[model samples]
Target: MVTTQRLPASLTPLDAALAAVLRDLAPVQPIELPPVDALRCIAAEMPALRAYPPHDVAVGDGWAMRANDLVGASSYAPLPLAGLPVWVEAGAAMPDGTDCVVDADAVDASGPLPQVLAEAVPGQGVRRAGSDIAAGRTVIAAGEPLLPRGLLLARAAGLDLVRVRRPRLRIVNISKGGLAVQLIADTARLAGAEVVRLKAGPDIVTIANSLDTGGCDLIITIGGTGVGHTDAAVNALARRGALIAHGIALQPGRTTAIGRIYTTPVIALPGAPDQAFAAWWAIALPVLDRLSGRRPRTTLALPLERKIASGVGIAEVVLLTRKQDHWAVLAIGDLSLDAIARAEALLIVPGGAEGFAAGTLVDAYMLRE
Candidate 1:
């Protein structure tokens, strides 16, 4: 089996490494799932099967009658009805030839013939057909998340299932299992991926065997990416398939690696939480987005509260907190757990330029969606 004998002579540019990671990647195939099960999944185009409220229905519990029949009716001058009006509850289909609803008190059924004491204009208390949803109209657009509101529309349209694309992500932890893997898995799940987690020792053969891409669209190996004696993730990837880049020009995650095995792309992250997190946001998430066909994530553009100083030739991850309409710098380069936890958003400083000055408007991605 082929193996990378040593560390990369020089770190690969972050942009170049990302391009290699995303080369020829495509979104996963769509699947049919119950609307409840599709929550948080990226939706394929889902057209409404039928119009909601297939027929006009009452919006409140009242007497269903012809609006024209109640003309000039009032509590002081009650108008006698020709026949007893239908008593309908809220959400019930409006009686045939009826156009509106009147309150219970408005209809005096105690007498032989009900007397109308209120007037209701047409559709005043009715929900019109097709108002909530139209037949053959797209309820959930492609690449949109399937939220509870979407499910309500689906159910109203008589749809039992929805079509969605949820990419399968396999995360292999090559270090002693701990918080790093859990953090990555949680992040992947939050990004709408189906995650399968596994653990492998530091042995090259074990890691190589765990690189199987049977049901996964992407693979991420946590740890075993540095030059330490036990760092064998990159070498194992070379043995299994191809090691495209073994080192990247990103601070806190310089030891990260990018490669491919069979048809699936693989990313190797440093064991440290900070470095792994940096590489994940900078490199892995873009690949995941391609696999899931997710729409572009929202980014907030706000002025910086303070100046940020970053070194040249290495991309840096900056954590920030929103404080009184400005982004306050929490931490840069080496990030602590507290800083990461407290950060509401994150910004990546490109490798070519110095950091932004205080009060410069910067685009940052929210940590939580």
Candidate 2:
């Protein structure tokens, strides 16, 4: 197995760790896919070929007629639906020369003809053409995520497919196939990436060096990142190329490592479930987002309900819960399944600060649970 190691101190600053590897990366080429499969993907360019609705349609079920025919009409004296008056249902295309809609609720349609008891004006209750969207107009920007609202817009614009940068990822794990592999695959796939999870057994060094990375934009090793003797991913990747950072200043994630093999970026994460989960979001996911042409995830502002301690040199990721109007830290012995399962939000403590006291206003990222 290949061997070379760039030893990092017990803890490395998170910002330094990220900068070393992200500087050389670029987004992958955009691919065309159906709108349903492109959720969360960054749009390359989206222009509508036709305007929404495509024609002037009625917004209500009423008589389609000229406003001049309804002049001086009131509850005391109603106008009859005579010449040129056309009966129109909601969403029906408005015929030529019609300019107003008189809802059935405001008129009596029994006995003779449909009539309006109230005066009507031009463009009243009538949706004009191109009001929603115009043909050939840019609907979405280049870097915006294709959220549900964006999908609706695309569908409305008569688009059945969208162009997006779908990243291809390789996830390396110690197991051949199981829940762990499934979880990692789901995480990467849900973020709009095509994933391939590889298993590296006892001879992780050999497997790591031989793992197929032909079309992969990024590789994430799910275990063998800690100080244990069996951990050899750091050395294996170093021999292949450059090891950016071996450790990050993060709680439950200090064992994380970021590097590059030839032209593909590789990241090493701890085996423990909680630590690996945190590291995925704190590190690996960000790399995937950039490679897939997406912007950073947004965070919210929330106040800490109680005091929480942390070392000055390393950043801490604390799980928080919603308590009435504010957020409170959910303390646990270590990051465990129970702890993560109960968390509703994540509180970040940067490396420069020592700790925080009660009522301290801090920025947080809400968990998707």
Candidate 3:
């Protein structure tokens, strides 16, 4: 059996740890899924089809005509064009001769029919086919996380299908039962990934040997990631491959370890409930996103209810929630499973975060989807 040593105790920010994990790890092959559909995933860098508006389209509900038609016409002396102005509403095809839109409001129907007080300028109120988007242009660039709005735009651009990166996560753990296991499985399900848990002894050889039959893309060990003698997951991972990072410079889940075994990403978390949860949330999630060619970003924010003390050297992720307009913490301990179970979001007290005041602006991640 091989033995591997850990890095310094300096706690790195969550992003940095993930970046280190992603370093040298090969990106997944892009796959052609289907027509440009689906909202959750991102589009492949170079899409399979060209985007549009190949030409300009209409923008408002009005008649399209040349600007010179209504040059001198006014509310009183409205211009009565010799040719009939084709009636069109918002988003209708412009008339063959119409180059601009004379809005319905800008015209009067006092005499025989609709008469415009003044003529419209060329290109006024007209949406050029390709004005909003151009055909043959890169609608969604590579490495950009596809948002709902972006997906809609891509569909509108006339793309029938897209190539996207499939981000698959593989989980290995000992606890296949209990609330912790249920919660872990639930988290993976919510993230739309597959999870695999293993019940191996804490011995490094036992854990390493079990992982040898590798079928997973990424491996996460639930128990035995701490400093205890029996905490051998990290050593096992290193024995199988190489250590990437160990013991980030932070709290509760500081013993968290990340490495690569046989070219697959491996992460080690504390055995305690809350610490393990925090480790997965803060470290594993971002690494997964990066490996999937996505930049990790979160929006769940919670204000600080009360002051919390933190170490000066390491970053801290304090769990917080909204309690009657004031933020209240369930507890500060890493083992405080109750608080983690009930948290609305994670309060990211960065490295060097001292104790915050009662009203400090703390940012947190949402626990629920």
Candidate 4:
């Protein structure tokens, strides 16, 4: 039966809602993936299998010679070479019995007897063995995102694959999928989750069946989370699993719901783009981080260019853009499409606080790198 219900008498607190969503959830096990495939994934500690540059190599195009041989050698008192020094190209392994490299011009090769015109210091212009990487050393630490720079180091260490934790996310669009769903999917993917998109309607059975959590670490349902007659996401979740929070004390996304099917976490977002976006930052992001064992996201502390007035009862989402050195508020409480698109960062005002005054230093989470 389709059971219609009224709005929640009192909305659940934001922190309590988040705690219920994270209850009994643990980080998924790490998997082996190629460095290219592991981009943005939470990396597992990777120990170098072998030392890089196992042998001394030239760092530049020059002649390899013994630094001791060129001691006190200068243009005024050129040291004559018994034999022409070995020519080594950049990146080539230095020949045995050589400890330094000198530029071609430093060697007077035009003359029948080559003479050293400049002194060379030991280890100059040469990359020593294990200088880039040491054997058995930790090159990539655990709980950090595997970026391109980390991948470069992995490749240099001769690692074909890296270990990372990438959570599988299933997005269930409870209505005709549109831009709102697309935005959520893209955001989840960018957060290092493998996204799978599904579709359903407002019908209880259809929405309940689509809530299946098999093979996915998390599920996010878009649309039908409100208290209207057609809003059946909360009812469907209650029938299929445990509904943790049906209404949250958050602006723009008050109808958002949190639940769990079996062991997988599920977040039901409203259909509106602004509402879904606000919930994404305030709720979904924390769940993703916990599932992937990701480290704390970076936030910038900057002063607000102007005063922001907010209600004291509900947590409000604030969109901001960097202006000169301070953060300029683009929109408060309800964010518009234009504001969301133009926002460079986001700030959330606590439920207890009314708002911030001008020149108040506030921490904002970066939306873009």
In order of lDDT, best first, we have 4, 1, 2, 3
**Which portions of model 4 miss their true places by more than 4 Å?**
48-50, 134-137
lDDT (tens digit, per residue) of candidate 1 on 123-194: 988999988777667767798877888788887777888899999999999877578898899999888789
lDDT per residue (tens digit) for residues 311-336 in model 4: 98799999999999999999998899
Q: What is candidate 2's lDDT per residue for 251-293, written digit by digit as tens?
A: 7778888888777888887777777777777788788888987
Residue 224, candidate 4: Cα error in Å is: 1.6
* Best lDDT among the predictions, by candidate number: 4
Candidate order (TM-score)? 1, 4, 2, 3
The lDDT values for all models are 0.89, 0.76, 0.67, 0.90
Q: Name the candidate, 3 or 4, with the larger TM-score value.
A: 4
RMSD of 3: 6.1
- What are the runs in model 2 whose C-alpha is more than 4 Å off? 1-9, 48-50, 104-118, 134-138, 175-180, 227-229, 331-333
TM-score of candidate 2 versus the correct structure, residues matched by position: 0.86
List, residue by residue over 218-264, the lDDT tens digit for candidate 3.
Answer: 77777766666456787887778887777886577888888877677
Error of 1 at 43 (Å): 1.5
